[model samples]
Structures are given as C-alpha cells and as structure tokens.
Target: MLAQVRSIGSRNACLAAGELPGGPWAARGGRTYRTGASGSTSEAITRARAIRSVTSVRGYQEVGRADLFIQVIPFASPEDARGGLTELRGLPRTMPQSKGLSDVGELRTVAPPTIAGTTHVEAAEQAFLLDGEHSRTLTVWCVAGQTVVVAALGGRSEAIRWPQLAEIVEAQVAALG
Candidate 1:
C-alpha cells in the first residue's frame, strides 16, 4: 500500500518502514505498522475474522513530521455503507473523550472536496497545541461502491496546508482505482 501511495507522484517519497535513502529527512527514521483487529493478538484476529469485514489497516508516519493512516473495510451492501457513515458522523462528538483530550477547539463535519466525484463524510479538527507544537488531523470516510475507506492525516501545523492535504487525499482515492 505504501508503494502504491508513493507511486502516485513525483515527490521523493518512500515506504515509511523501509530503508532510508539519503535525503533531507533521511536522518529521521520513519515507520509504519498495522493496527486494529487485523493485526492484533490471536483472539482479536479470530473475532475480526468472525464478525468484521475490514480488509486492511495501515499506518504511516514520517518520524517527527507527518502521518497518514488508512483502513479499508468492505460492507455487504450500500445500506451497510450508509449505516457506517452514520456511525462515522458521531466521531466529532466522541473523539475528544476517546483521546482524553480536554481542549478540543473545533470538531465539525465538512464537505470533502474531491476531484473524483466520490461523495465523502469528512470531519476536521482545528489545529491544537500538542506537546507544545501545533497540530491538526482530518478524517475522511468515503464509500466507494461497497468499500468504506477511513483515511486520516495528521501533520505539524506548518508542514501541510489544507489544500495540500486535500490534494493528497484526492490522489490517494485515484490511486485506489
């Protein structure tokens, strides 16, 4: 998946967990790992296989810089996708509590501006100080046919502007094709 992501553009991007070729950010080692039931312990794996349709889970991080994580879960039907979207809509309300965060600045739903004409339920959290540095995260949940895509991007406040991040998501959607 990281390879597919890196092939989308000319930018000098590489798999987060692979060897670092000499470059500006070479000294900062990056890593990626799978999460959720798909990669968890044996009991969780059994439960995931029994009841969940999650196909993949991957997380990418550029050391101290930025991060992108994606999970692909395929539903049985469009109706299931709709239900999933409704569940995702509650993210804004539950996120702060889940993270043990008290200073949630703004949490609201936003229309995802996509070039591919795929409708998505998007939510963004306003930049907030984390460990004394400003940071923000955006999550976009889209149903492409019967597959529900959950993509999240997090970055240092200065590293990525909104437009750039949107473009990255758009490219990722295109790559999914």
Candidate 2:
C-alpha cells in the first residue's frame, strides 16, 4: 500500500500502511468527480478505472500489432498534473530502462513500451516518441484544470499519433476547471 505523511498536531508524522489521507482529504483541490465512498479497495480501483475513459481520434493506428497499446491520464488536478510530472522524474531510479530521459519529459518502462512528456500551457505541446518496440504507449499527466491525454501508436510510421493526442490534450485542458 502507498504510505502517507501526516501531522498529528504541530509535528509531522508518518502513518502506517493502510491509512487514509486523514479526515475528508489530506490533499484536495477542486472537488473530484467522485461521490460517495467505495466499499472496498478493489471497488476504488474499479471506480478510478471507470472515471478514466478513452476516446478515439485520428493519427493513432492499430492496423497490425501483436500487443495493442492504450494511453492513459494518471491524474487531472492542476497541482497533481504539474507535481505528478515533477514526481515522475524520480521514476527512472525506481523504474530502470527509462532509455534516458529526453528533451520532452521522463518516461517509465512498461509492457508494450511507453513514452511520457510535459507541455507548458503557454507553449502548448506534448512531446512524444515511440521506442524501438513495435507497439508504443504514451500517457500525459497534465496540470489540474488542464486536459491529460496520451496515445498508443502501432509502429514508427504511427508517429502521426502525436498530433492527434496533442489536439485532444488541448481540448481536455480547456475543459478543466
């Protein structure tokens, strides 16, 4: 289970495993779409999965590949978006085979391969690329109040998926509160 740090009074304390965020929220931004408590952790995971939906757009192709790929937005709060990417930088140590980070952002090695990057709202871009693998997966963690998107492309020729993911990423950011 993921550990959490908290403050009992004025002193900071580290809670044991299985501890909740504390009270209603140890961390909260604008309210999440989640309502009501889930019965179990499995249920929570299911809920999280359900909230994240996939929409197809041009540029991504799955014409022919043994392993199919999918893109996912891990979190969607402004702080979570920015902080998450910032936190991801440390993933290289925990997750080897990062292929050395790129000018875009940090990436973690996963099944079917993966690409990750960040786009300054001002600059407006999602830097991405497929690894040597035949199939590639990408996940964009955007700042809260912004859209988070990623794309899975079939092969090297599928580089076109970047532009399509970029468009949706922009729209999602626009939709954010």
Q: Write the per-residue lDDT of candidate 2 for residues 51-133, one digit (tens) a residue.
A: 44222222322234211222223332434435434543233322124573233433443322122233532112223333543
Each prediction's RMSD to truth: 8.4, 16.5
The models' CA-based lDDT, in order, is 0.50, 0.30
Q: Which residue ranges in model 1 land beyond 4 Å of their true spot? A: 1-52, 91-102, 115-117
Worst 10 residues of 2 by lDDT: 1-10
Best by lDDT: 1
Tens digits of per-residue lDDT, candidate 1, 73-94, equal: 4444555555565555554343
Off by over 4 Å in 2: 1-61, 65-77, 92-139, 144-154, 158-161, 171-177
Alpha-carbon TM-score of each model against the true structure? 0.58, 0.31
lDDT of 1 at 83: 58
Best by TM-score: 1
